[model samples]
Target: MHYRLICFDLDGTLVETAPEILDAVNDTLEQFDLPGVEQSQVERWIGHGTHELLVQALAYASGVEVQAVRAMPRLFAIGQAFDDHYARRCGTRGRLYPSVRETLYELREHGVRLAVVTNKESRYTQRVLSQHGLNTCFDRVVSGDTLPAKKPDPRGIEDCMRAFAVPPGRTLFVGDSSIDAATARRAGVAVWLLPYGYNMGQPIEACAPDRTIPSLASITDTASSSSSS
Candidate 1:
């Protein structure tokens, strides 16, 4: 195979975490006597890091315009509260996406290095992965809190490349968001996107990944065909 490493996005790509995330966000909102967000809105709010999500959610819930810099500190506190709640209740409603385990196993069998690059907090990400028995499947895991900068900055991808000792041309980044596409582009690696994952309510196809798959398992066939060509 031409690809030596495959990096995956955590939240929407490998796991369906919407239910738990929405629940946690709602719980935190309730504590503040704020109106809860709609499920669809929460879905769209994801993909960015936790702080960004919280800021947007708070702005939406309080009817405060997002441009208010004065409210940022309070929103950051609410975001931290949401993160705490999520950590306590993480994975309670989340599960591996269909075919995720099978695909990871197959890729591991083929000796392809695998890593997770996500905007989730490192400790929480570790807890969720361990609880779901996915910790062993990945050779390395990079969380949003793992570095000073998150996706779209190329730092996380650069870290992944360093961990795997793989060059950009030989690495494949699989994700479900424009953030991932941006990260791949910045890192100079090939990118594949999954249609079923979150893309901040935008059509993932518009991100123009090198390839798009309906599911993670489909990458096997796509990779095989790409190698042959």
Candidate 2:
């Protein structure tokens, strides 16, 4: 394939983590006597990291604006509670997307370096990757907290490209959201978005990613095309 390095987004991209994320959110909400949110809402709120999702949930439950949730004097305590709940719920119900493991192996076998750049916080990202047995597949992992800024800023993708010594033309970002598409665009790399992952309730096609892929399995075609050429 033309690409030397591939960076992935977590949550909706690599893992279907909304089920557990919903569980964690509701768990935290119940502790504070707040109404629980639905899985659909949680899925829609994903891609921004756990804290942001929790803020959205609290906002919805309390009929307060997201900014109000963020400004709540006890927001820190509430965030801490959410952290504990999410940590416990991290890997319990999450699963890798179709063809993810096989594709990761295929790419690795062909000398394609892999990395994960996720808006998910470091703790949740590590737990999910380890639970899915994907820890060793990546040459590097850059979580939301790893850098000063997260997705749409492109720092994570750029950092991975620099670490791999690969230029934008040789790098590809695979993800499931507009955030990922924007990040890759800003970094001058190609991005392929999956249709099934979270795109903030919008169609992935609307994001106008370089390619709107059906699944991770299609990535293997790159190797075949390279060989045939």
Candidate 3:
């Protein structure tokens, strides 16, 4: 096999999780009697994980700086409230990006180990995967809470490499944001960015990924080219 493993970012790469995330954030805001945030606002806040998302959203809704919100005595309680709301809302309305399911099967058939590396908490990540019938697609999953550090740190990707016994040279990270690109770079692995994901409202090309594809349907092309090279 040219590449032994293909590690994927969950939100914006394999799945359109913003809807569910938006719902949870808005619901939590409503619970606290704060104004709900818009989907576009939540999209920009994603890729950073749930805690950061909530911090930014709460700040936006309350017209305060993020640090101010963080210093609030109720921040922890609000985070817990978000956890509860997000748990109930996970995968309730999100969807797999086009060609994701088929592409995973194709890659797996060629003996490539697949894994999910996301900033989402493990509990919600697992729940979302199962809800989308994607639990079996990946051989392993590494979430934000899986280790002390998350994306933009290389531990998650490195962990996946170790689990699959694949070296950085033989691994590819597929994702949709600068966070993903930075993670892959820190791990010394190649990365491919998808054009359609969130990416904090920036163009995926701005991340300078090794390659950009419109969808996962073209992943086999990357695999084939790598094998030939």
Top lDDT prediction, candidate number = 3
C-alpha RMSD values across all candidates: 1.7, 1.3, 1.1
Candidate 3: tens digits of C-alpha lDDT, residues 1-229: 5888999999989989899999999999999999998889889999888889999999999999989999999999999999999889987889999999999999999999999999988988898899999999999999999999999999999999998799999999999999999999999999999988888989888899999988999999877887897
Q: For residue 192, what is the lDDT in candidate 1?
A: 93
TM-score for all models, in order of appearance: 0.93, 0.96, 0.97
Cα displacement (angstroms), candidate 2, residue 34, comes to 0.5
Worst 10 residues of 2 by lDDT: 220-229
Candidate 2 residues lying further than 4 Å off, grouped into runs, are 223-229
lDDT assessment of candidate 3: 0.92
Question: What are the per-residue Cα lDDT tens digits for candidate 2 across 72-104?
Answer: 998899889988998898889989999999999
By lDDT, the better pick of 1 and 3 is 3
lDDT of 1 at 120: 80
